[model samples]
Target: MSTSITIFDTTLRDGTQGEGISLSADDKLKIAKKLDDLGVHFIEGGIPGSNNKDIEFFRRVQSLGLRAKISAFGSTRRKHSLAEQDENLQRMLAAGVPAATLVGKAWDFHVHTALQTTLEENLAMIGDSIAYLKRKGLEVVFDAEHFFDGYKHNPEYAAAVLSRAREAGADWLVMCDTNGGTLPGEVHEIVSAVGLALPGAPLGVHTHNDCELAVANTLAAVQAGARHIQGTVNGYGERCGNANLCSLLPTLQLKMNYTCIPHESMAQLTNTARYVSEIANVNMPVNQPYVGSAAFAHKGGIHVSAILRDSRTYEHIEPEKVGNKQRVLVSELAGQSNVLSKAQQIGLHLDPSSEQARKIIDRIKELEHQGYQFEGADASLELLLREATGEIDELFTFESFKMLVEKTAGGSVVSEAFVKLNVAGESLYTAAEGNGPVNALDNALRKALIPYFPSLRDMHLSDYKVRVLDEQDQTAAKVRVLIESRDYRTAWSTVGVSGNVIEASWEALVDSMRYALLGLHSPQPVRTEFGQRGLVNH
Candidate 1:
């Protein structure tokens, strides 16, 4: 069996069909460059006939000199239309790309109900389109849309569709589970049967994630003799998603030993996934296989302890292989090993058997019991670690802060905050107005500290969340606030808990500023107790 597999990425085309995913021509071009850098075999840009943006992308993409062949996606001409005269086919030719992906109806039900055409006519459409594209000297990939469902319903008609495409010189025959409802066992069996019947034809597989088995099904198909695999980055697509190439590429090369992408380009997988998510304005799932933030994160006491001795005890593959690093998260469940690992991760030195390490572990459990979570709040955890070790000094001390709200007769409202701080023994005061109390407080705090710590100018809160610990306490319930702050270089998160939401926001906001200052300036530790107002002792 040939080990070389063709990777077909349909992110720009089918991935855009996902909810809330919109990419301009420029965005598509940028992603295409990244995909080329990662060494994918084919990039399905989009259907040029459907949108002017895709047409523009093709025109601009030609100048990029990418290694991957850009494939223009479209259907098999039209139901009753001639291939040469079909507008969609003409657009593909004008796209000026080297490849074409033409999806045609393989299901008899779709042919009858959706296309409202005869089965023989659909076969003719498939044959004519592939032959036309072949004559034009473009590599043609015929996507047998709904092939699995069609095969289950009528095996003969489905087999006829594959035969027509094969005889028409289609470079690849891709069996698609269009509805995304095929099981892995069924996919393997059907793909095996097709490969046997088709003889020398190059078989491919395209699947969806409706059943959440798209990746499993694709793997099964590959095991059954399919070579070309179609998927989207981060699994973005119409319904649940398409098969995720982010997960597929690694599994194929590292586990299955299938030659898919360049071995050196494998490390770019996580970056590519994150870059696409950044451009698409979507949050990459933290638990996403291989690339997610929490993919290699060890939090359990035993897991962290085992990983410290030998990472293979807890990790399947080395995280660095995919441009991700193992993270040791500290929480109530953390042991001495977790603390030691996390301390090392942050460039802090702490003896594993020392009383300081035990104290820190006990303190984390104590804080977590008070509704403070440190797993997602790395900056806060770092600050706590430093404080425990007596390394962090007070850059500034908070004296008092207040918020004011006003409502007019016109139904307009305004929020303002006043902050007083002791910076290097100088009592400084500032005030700012914002759309909300938290925003106003953040602005005011930044105003008071920017002069002392100029790095505060680049830092801004990116995300903030408040989780109420006890709904039974209603409005009086304590809330845990997590604040994510980012400067030009990196981002960090901090946590604070209080019965008053504003007070909780204040603690998190202070920790964010303190963490930023610790990186640039080192001073003596401040007073180490919480005052009556839950403020750090000055």
Candidate 2:
């Protein structure tokens, strides 16, 4: 048997089923290119003819010239119907893709309840669908939907289903944990049994994360002689999710020593994960394994010190292997090593034993006590370090600002802000209106500064988050505001804390603008102390 594994990605089809996840045809194409570059074996484009967007994707994907085979996903022919006459099967053929993945009922319970079809008819649907597609010279992948549950409930019937699919020339017989309830042990035993039953037959595994065991189950199946793995990027799918290819790819390649993607393409894993999340407009969880922002971050003083000496002390694998980097986070729990490491990260050099490092550490603790978190606000931390080290000057001195909120009798509300600033020893005043107080202030501030620094025109806020530090204080509690800003080339985050929400937002906004202006005006090169150019996300 071949030792290499086939990676089939269903992000465009199954991933779109995730709640709040939607992608345009262009977005699907962009992701398809990324996946192809990453060397995924198969890219399940989508169920053609199911929706306008998917149909458009199939039409356009042909010209992408991707290396991966584009698989058109669909169900088996309808019960008691000829495969050639089934509209769904016909559409799959019309898609003109190189492969066809047809899902058919393997669980007897679903056969009886969901499809309301007899066992014989279901088997016929599976067989006819494969035979029809095979006759068209298309590689057919038979998705045995709920095969694990089907086998546990009725092993004989499940084996018969696989036998029929293989006989019908199915290139891949996939056992699916459709409900995602099967344990890893069960997957291993069942997959082993199937491998023993049909020697030399190609097998695959697809699992969902309902039990949070999809990745584990897939690994078990692979160890049990299954050579194909099906999953979605970042584990996106209906309900819980499908197995996460982000976690599976690196584990299979680096840990298991299996030949999945090419060795060079493995480094693109993190970027691909983030790219898919960006196109889908979904937030990739920070704690997600292998590819998340926090996957290789070290915050504790001891951990940072050890990792600085030897990264293997705290990390299982070098993050750079997956296109990510190590980050040393600074907080109250930090030591001098953390401050120095972070300073070096942002192009500032601070001696570990120097008074500058001591002061910066003290200031970080003091600010953190005031509800400031630097872990997610690297720009703000860099600003603090530069100010403490006398490496930067204030870009703007706050004079004063006022906000006016008016509500008409019709319940329509408007907020306006006026700001006075001294730029280059000149006093300037600006006013603007916005949907909210913070927006008005941001608009007024930007209006006052855009002409002085045209680069600021390209800068815009991407995300804003506020957290109440002490809920017991209720309406008067201090709030921490974080703002993420991006210009055309770089993205940075800043943080501020104050008892007033507007004040906190204004503080964060001011820090964001000042950081941008500092980078624009600084005489130093853009490279950090480590000689890496561009902004490094923490």
Candidate 3:
């Protein structure tokens, strides 16, 4: 068995501190439950006394029967007030958490300048707060804020602050790289000194990523005897952000030989990252370590071909281990093997060494030269593959379409869309009104196809993304649109491109619906429920 490292997740606290990311009490509870399910050891819910929302979150999470211990965060007691009489302490206690984390200014500079108190009073506050919480039978974690910078400035004073908390029986003395400027080498040295000073207490490391080194710093601190790691999921926090547990947890378990959560379900790491982002309503970072969409994506021909031969060639770890799938993108740089493998994955069979494959590859490069990228428009690529392999059945063809929009006096816009389609030697015409021309067009197209393909009812646009192809004027911009849709079960995305935004959107929309219908005709085996499964289907 490997050594166990406690995952102290501060997603509810520091994560919410990110700009425009606010979770309601219910959202916090939902996220907390997800973390519990993910096997986190400790959930730092939030600073209960800081706001009514956090207080309510703590109150609700207390009775949640969570396997993970809920911890309420707060600063040390005020200088003039007794620990028991401190309103912040009172609120923390009232929140009824199993543990509490009390942060104190460890640096003499913060004590003098920020707290406007003498160093002696700051030490007194740390001792009193920890002692008070320990006496109340709550496990206490003392956060030594700015301890690295503090030690750099005044090593004796910083060590003295830890000594006070340790003597007061704080379970863990956490050193915070508050400014997030410390290097990994600096972290190892500072943590080593602090660990030596407070020999009996367990050491914890809380790092921010101002220099994009929080994960590296945390790893170094752990190597230097820190036992607990504090971070927010996906590194959501103020400034550059806190240490990302998504990256840290994997590195610790896979590379450092430390035990963290269950190895069997380590695959959930990517899903957990995205789940948190979805709940926070933030756009998922495309390059986030382990979980990002591009984490396992292969683009260049040489890389893609090598990956197909052996994924280990280009991948650090198996994509499935982090609930991600290896994606071979179709691009001008793709080889025949890359195209064949990707097409086969989507159930299209083509001989990689055949002329057809070479022709398709050449066509792809031609289209790419014309500003058609298959990476973001996978649905169009799939259609191309199907057409090449003679698997596509022409169910319907577009004849002509026109759209009109008018602005009303109340500042509302009304849009009218008309579409004509030819299916099985029959022409169908339909018109609809919507809030926007694209929506009206979509509605009209769906209505026209409803009579022929009733399965269209199972489809609805889930998300739409548009990107400008050229860097010139907005009017002359060649736009690419991606449309995501879902039926009763699976979700797939399609892409379209044109100089006109509406045309690009329309192409993506049609391809998305077509993919859904095709998937329904040949459905994959059931794995798990929709909400329980990860976005990447390996």
Candidate 4:
């Protein structure tokens, strides 16, 4: 029989504390619903009394009938105030959540300095807060804030905090590494000691990533008998960030033989991480553990070939187990398999040993040498393959383009662009003005092509990234531009590079629109239509 670990996701509460991430009440509810569907045991919704958004979030989420227990988060009652009379405690109760997590100072330093209270006063507050919340019919999880560092400083005092929570009838006592500086050995030692001290109470662990050891410290705590694991998806939080449940859950279930969420639903981990990021409007970390875009991505030829033979040679776990897929990046270092796989994804079939495949690989390498990275620009890579195989019709070609940028006194900068296109044995010239040279050029190009391809109206730039490849000379330097575009449901990225920023942008912009058009016009056999016609004839 295996022990079951409770996954308490604080992404909505703590993850949103990360700088530049501000989720409204509605966004919090939406993400909370997603986490509940992802099967987390507890959802730390927000600090209920902190702001209106959080207060409203609790109200909105109550109607969701979520499977996971929603926990309102707040600190313990103030030093001089009675637990029942404390405004913060009252707010948690008024939120109407079934559970609440209340944090109290476990560190003697914080007790004496930060809270301006003695160690004895802190203990009383912790006990009284938990007792009050428990009496209110809310499951109270006592967060022993800064417990690890406190244990190191005063072992007896830290254990006393756990003993206090146990006596107060708290549902679970979560030991927190607030500063996130504790090592795994220290974590194992402290959790072992605390477990012995409060054997009657359920033990939980909350760690931060200050030393990049949040995940390690969390797992060590589990091995030492702590059952509940509290963290955010993707390890998002203030400072160095919280422990990452994304990495911890998989390790515990697969490696340590602990029961986490259901094995079948574990596949939702990667998408869940991205879904949260999308709602928060934060760019997902491409290299984050378990769920990142580059988590299982193979770029080197040696590694790619090895993974193709046996994924176990390079990968620690099957990507599909965590709802992620292995990606073979087509680059200058890519092999024949990489090219073939990429071509197959775009519905293109090519003989791997043939001249066309060789040409495509050579062109990729050549473009990479010129600062075009295909890994981030798959749309451009696909267009290159089509053009190299003569699958693309040269319906129109660029003859020349020029952009003029001028700044006027006490006014905004003005840009005018002229574009020339050679199409159907005739020349179409267009001009447009915009806020910037790139914008002007884009407007002129779109104006010229909109008549021919009406689908251009559906296309728009999603993201644009510009990186200077050579930083030695600021004035004359090579730059790389990555452009992400979308046409309704489909999105694609393209890359361009040159010493001239406008030219690089133009190259990527053209490829982005071409990819969108290709997706819209590409034919697909309709099985439903064929089946209907067959039934009618019969």
Which one wins on TM-score? 2
The whole-model lDDT of each prediction reads: 0.91, 0.90, 0.85, 0.85
What TM-score should be assigned to candidate 2?
0.94
Error of 3 at 213 (Å): 0.4
Candidate numbers sorted by TM-score from highest down: 2, 1, 3, 4
Q: Which ten residues in a row have the lowest lDDT in candidate 4?
A: 529-538
Cα-based RMSD of candidate 1: 4.9
Model 2 worst lDDT window (10 residues): 529-538
Residue-pair clash count for candidate 3: 0
RMSD of each: 4.9, 5.8, 6.1, 6.6
Q: Is candidate 3 or candidate 4 better by TM-score?
A: 3
TM-score, each model?
0.92, 0.94, 0.92, 0.89
Stretches of candidate 1 above 4 Å error? Answer: 522-538
lDDT for position 375 in model 3 = 80
Candidates 2 and 3 compared by TM-score, better number: 2
